[model samples]
Target chain A: MDRSVLSIIKCFGTELYNALKDAQDDISEIRIRKEKSVVVYKQNIPYAVTKQGLTALELDNAKNEYITVSEALIKDAFAQLCSYSVYRFQNDINNGFITVNGGHRIGICGTYVGENGIMRSVRDITSLNIRIAREYKGCSRKLADIAGCEGGILICGVPSTGKTTMLRDISRLFSTEKMLKVSVVDERGELSAYSHTSNGFDLGLCDIYCGYPKQKAVICAVRTMSPDFIVCDELTGEDIESVCFTVNYGVKMIASVHCDSLENGLKNVSLFRLLKTGAFNKVVFLNRSIIGKIDAVYNIGDIQKLYE
Target chain B: MNNMKIIGAVLIILTSWLTGIMLSKRLSQREELLIELKQLLSEIKRRITYEMPTMCDLISNCGTQYLKPFTDNMYNSLSGGYTINESVISAVADTPLLCVLQDCEKQLITDVLSSLGAADSTSVREITDSAIIQLDHYIGLAQENRQKNSKVYFVTSLYIGFAAVILMI
Candidate 1:
């Protein structure tokens, strides 16, 4: 790819990431104007292609239009795409978010019902944004030097810090170049949003287990999948303890965690426990600009050495 | 002589009127009580018809090998040990029949505690105490259910008896 094309691609990714991070409600549509073509993604799936300008639907109007997009159309689109439907778009006012096969994520927004500090589910889902997954060909090249022949690495950053994007790229690189068997525990369909036999990105030799609760999925994957490397995002609670225990079985893990800074990452009780267990061989910290710039990467072992 | 006769007539009228008011008020209070009792009895009957089977199942399951093994297996499966305690507590607390069954379980536990060595007695007592707490909760729930049902039955019978008396008259 030309350097200018690469620059434009980076810019597009940066802009989209920012928009997603700042999003207060569901993002109805994402329009990317490439040099050659204009691609419009609706409910995280690309819906239309045109050379001319298109009006992206506002949150409320988008929901209304989505209701009109018949269940038959949705089902057909999903079937043609080979993605299993996790949820259905019922009303523009309720039951809106849908999870398809292969870890592709779509955001749903409407009135919410919260009980006992748990989101039981969503209601009155007026808007849905289906985010298409695409793998950058050489996105992991920047961190290849730090990866150092693969042991276990932890990727830590705040929300929308390109952690999932980075993990997807690394998984792709590992599958394609290293020819390693990668098992992805995608709790939410983000990393490998492959649906209906078509993957948002080309993940070579990867077996993905999607929609399982994170810790349970990890344990199940470790037992049955027998992956060369297990990759997951957003570790929490006892998940760190489980990860520590799994390391004893000699399975390499690559996971991303949410944290603002390296100090905060260390201070996290779960993260601290995982570190103390000597499970993680490396930790990579991500820094991004307001426009999603790749600011810096740090070695976890190096940070530990400084602390010691 | 005229004044004395007027006073006597006034006294008689006052007595009769007071008696009538007292009788009417007593009857109204009885009617209210009967209505409340009837409501409570119907509620109890409904609960017995609908919720009793599930409660029976829960009680039977609490002591069965199937439930015990299932609980144990779930406990072992999860990484956390506290899961087992939580599950056991939840199962015991949620079952409607637990109030009655808990006392029986407690007696058994107490006997075991007495037979055990002195060192083991402390641990046994702790377990018994927890179980007793759960039992008490069930007992309270059961009493509430009984009160609701009994009241309904009492009111219904009272109304039927009153109707029969009226028909006889």
Candidate 2:
């Protein structure tokens, strides 16, 4: 077993830890809220952990199968996670989460402490959401045939649609085999494949700018790395300006954005304007229902369906 | 043979007197050591707040030579897979001076070390302040004892040795 899993298991008692281990492969997230039954997720399906293992979603009933997280457990886990120095991670906690050693992000939910429109701290944390990081190698292989030659590709999908995973594999494929100059702007250290063991990390000749904001990292990666391709996970409104900058620099870029429908994605005025300027050639929509299947491929400028 | 016997008796009395003085000397040293430790805690708190160095770095640089063992114990425990809180608490709780320290003093040191590096600026200040106050109280007591009872131990030891010699005679 990976040490990361064991580290996470330390937060749970013996029984819950064993149950989680049995279903570790299927788990995408483990939610531990105060006085609530532990919620486990496989893809998008929620399951309350039973004594034996994961059973069907049974939240309302306070049964023996369910485990309620205690304040003491959270304290122990947080202290261990911060290496027993909470001061070191105060800023991270104020931001509502801290990414652990294995790139697993533990989102903190607590009362916010702020002054003058700036967040000062978070106190009395009551819930934690642990998002387990996993790499599905070759998940982006299908996009290679179509959007391979496109200048800038944007993968659109809702949450849990595997967009980030797909982007990670594509970077792997491009850098390892083809030996393309690849720079990844891994803002949260999520997409760099840094969390994986030796077997999982085949980033192969790619440069990763981890934990930098998307805009700054993208520009820095372009100027310093001088890569043929730059991969960034998740695009937002603030990213439009830098994406345009990368486009002008003639560096092919791949980024993911959260939007279920292509129409909704293009509805953003800045994104539409950028698309109209011929910045991106292809926008691939991922259908969560199909799980990694492309819903449609729209060619920019023409706004024509290239292929479905 | 009489002169040699006299010399031996004088040597025996001198050893007893010095042993009594040693106790007083140790108490004074302990008082000084506690003061130095409070200053070191101040240094650590300052560094943690502004410099924000790693725990290992903080431990190494927080103390003078006198406090090296305290910091060293923590640093070594960190490598031995103990949490910072646990390691620090163990060092103080298993103190070499546990036999000498009051129960409250031992508890204060342990509590401070356990929570020192794991709090925000405000809370860290509170922890250090509390520890320093406790140390100050102990230091005052040590100084008082050094003044009031140093002569008592010396005189008591001399008198006892003289009586023992008289009885023999």
> Which runs of model 1 end up more than 4 angstroms from their true locations?
A1-97, A100-104, A114-120, A126-132, A290-294, A306-308, B1-169
- DockQ in order: 0.01, 0.43
Q: What is the CAPRI rating of model 1's predicted complex?
A: incorrect
Give the C-alpha lDDT of model 1. Answer: 0.50
lDDT of each: 0.50, 0.75
lDDT per residue as tens, model 1, B21-109: 45444444433432332332233233333332222232233324333433343333222322223434544455342333435543433
Model 1 lDDT per residue over A222-263, tens place: 888777788888877668766875687777888888777777
What is the alpha-carbon RMSD of candidate 2 to the true structure? 4.7
TM-score for each candidate, following the candidate numbering:
0.44, 0.79
Candidate 2 residue runs with Cα over 4 Å from true position: A193-202, A269-279, A304-308, B1-14, B17-68, B75-84, B97-112, B121-169
Candidate 1, residue B142: how far the Cα is off, in Å: 47
Could you tell me the TM-score of candidate 1?
0.44
